[model samples]
Target: MQGLSAWRDDRCLYCDVDLSLPTGTVMQIRGPNGAGKTTLLKHIAGLSGRRAGQVSWASTDSHDDRDTFTQQMLYLGHLPGVKSALTVAENLQALAACRGINLLTHTISQALNTVHLGGYDDMPCHQLSAGQLRRVALARLFTEPVPLWLLDEPFTAIDQAGVRELEGWLAAHSEQGGVVLLTTHHPLALNCPLQFLDLQPIVEDWH
Candidate 1:
C-alpha cells in the first residue's frame, strides 16, 4: 500500500504509510491496545471503507485496482467468522463457496486433519473448543492459494504446537512469493524477514 491511512470513529488510528512491499514479504503490525493495528490492516484488506491517502497494489493503476486487489487478497479478521449453527465441514464448505472455490470432500478432510481437527468435521462449531473453532477457521489457509494474506490476531486461542505450525504455514507462503501481513502479540518464528510497523500516535511513519 502506498500512503495508506485509516480512521476509527473520529480518531486517526493509522497514519500515512508509504509502503512498497515486494513479493515474499512478511510484515508484522505492532502497537498497544486500541493503537489501530487492526484498523490499519482492515484498510489494507479493503474492509475499512473510510480511508485517507492513496493505496495501490503492485503496478496496478489506482483507478482500476479494486477487482485486481480483491482477487489477490484473502483476509482473516480477529473473529474466526465461523457459524455456530453449522458443523465444522459445513463452515469450511460455506467459506469455499463464498470464495468461488469448490473444495472436494477429501480436500476439506485434509485441511481439518492439518489443523489437528481430523475427527471433528461433523461436530457443530459451538460444540468445539475455542481453539478447535480457530483451527476450523484457519483451514482456509490450506483450501486455496492467493498472493496476499491479511491476518489479525492469528495466534489467538492456538496452542504452542498450533502456533508453530501456523508460523511454518506463513513462512511457506512467503517463500512462495506471497505477501503476508499479520498482527500478533506473541513473537513469530518465521524463516523470512519480519518487517514490523509499530503503530503509535506519536510515531506516524512506517518503520
Candidate 2:
C-alpha cells in the first residue's frame, strides 16, 4: 500500500504539499484551475524532478531501480500522446514497442473497440474528432498490461459514454490489484470503493 511521498518548494507549481498514496487505492486529486494537479501527477509518473521532498517507491530490495519503477507505471496526460500523421493502430504499436510490449493488430483492434473506436482504427489521428482522439489515447489501457496508471484530466474532451467506458476500465484495473492515480473535475460513478484526495485546498493561491 505505502508508496511515494511528494512535496514542493517556493518555485514549485503545487507549493508545499505532501501525499502518501497506498497501492491498489484509487486516489482522486481534485483542485481548481492552476492548482498543479497535473504537475503532481507528472512527479508521481517520474516525468518531472522533485524540488524538495522525495518520491519513494516501496521495494523489498536494497536499492530502488528506476527502470523497474518506470516499467511498472503508465502516465496518460491531458494531451493524447499520438502522432497526428499515424493511423490509430500505428500509434498503439509504437507505444507498445517503446514499452517493450509487442502488440498485435487484433489486440489493437480490440483496444480500439473497447474505447468505441473500432471503425476508426485505420484513420489518422488528425482526422478524428476530439472525443474520438481521446478514445484512441485511452485504447492503450486495454492493449497493454501496466500495474500503475497515472492519468491527468482523463475526462477532459470525452462524452458521457466515454466517461463511463473509462470508469469501467478503471474499475477493472483496480479489481486486478492495480493502482490508479488521476485528476478529474467530473464525478465518477463506479461499483467499487473509492477515495478522494482533495488538492483544492492545497493550491488555492495559484488561482
Candidate 3:
C-alpha cells in the first residue's frame, strides 16, 4: 500500500501509511489501542473502502484485477464467523463453500485436527467454549489454498500451546513462499524474521 489514509468520525485514525510485503514474508502490525491496526488490515483485505491509498498485488494494481486478487487472499477478522447452530465440521464446510472452495471429508477432518479440534468435529459449535470456537475459525487457515493471509488478533482467547502452534503455522507458510500480515499482542516466537509496521497516533510524528 502507498499513501494509505483513514478517518473515523472525522478523526484521522492514520494517514500517509505505506507498506510492502513480498512472498515468504511475515509482517506484524504493532500499536497501542485505537491505533488503526484493524483498519489497516481491513483496507488491505478490501473490506473497507473509506480510505485513500493504492494496494497492489504482484506489481499490478489491486483495483485492476480485484477478482484475481480476491481469489489469492484470505482475511480473518476478530469474530470467529461461525454459525452457532452448526456443527464444527458443518461450519468449516460452510465457510469453505462461501469461498467457493471444495473440501473433501478427509480434508475437513485434517484441518480440524490441525487446530486441535479433532473429535469435536461432530459437536455443535454452540456447545464449544470460546477458545474452541476460535479454533473452529482458525481451522479455515489449514484448509485455505490461498497464499496471502490477513489476520486480525488471530491469537486471541487461545492457550499458550495454541499460540505456539499458530506461530509454527505462520513460519511454515512463510517458508513455503506465502505472505502473512497479522495484528496480535502476543510476542511471536517464530524462527523466521518478522517485519513490523507501527501505526503511531496522528498526534505523533511519523517517519
Per-residue lDDT tens digits for candidate 2, residues 1-207, read: 223334455443554466655666787888777566887788666676553445555642212566777777788999988899999988999998988899988898888877888877789888988888788888888777788889988887998877887898888888888888899888889767788766553433665
Error of 2 at 6 (Å): 7.7
Tell me how far the alpha carbon of residue 169 in candidate 3 is from the true structure, in angstroms, after superposition: 0.5
Estimate the TM-score of every prediction: 0.91, 0.85, 0.94
RMSD of each: 3.4, 3.6, 2.5
Q: What's the lDDT for residue 52 in model 2?
A: 40
Give the TM-score ranking, best first: 3, 1, 2
**Steric clash pairs (candidate 1):** none
Candidate 1 Cα misplacement greater than 4 A, ranges: 61-63, 202-207
Give per-residue CA lDDT, model 3, range 1-207, as digits (tens).
799998887778899998989899999999999999999999888887578889998887888999888888889998888999999888888888878888788998998888988888789989999999899989988887789999999998999889999999999999999999999999899989899999977774567
At residue 177, what lDDT does model 1 achieve?
Answer: 94
The CA lDDT at 5 in model 1 is 74
Error of 3 at 66 (Å): 1.5
Worst lDDT run of 10 residues, candidate 1, spans 54-63
Assess each prediction's global lDDT (C-alpha) against the native.
Answer: 0.84, 0.76, 0.90
Candidate 1 lDDT, 69-142, residue by residue in tens: 77678889888999999999999889888878888989989988999999888999989888988898899888
Model 1 gets an lDDT of 0.84
Q: Which candidate's lDDT is highest? A: 3
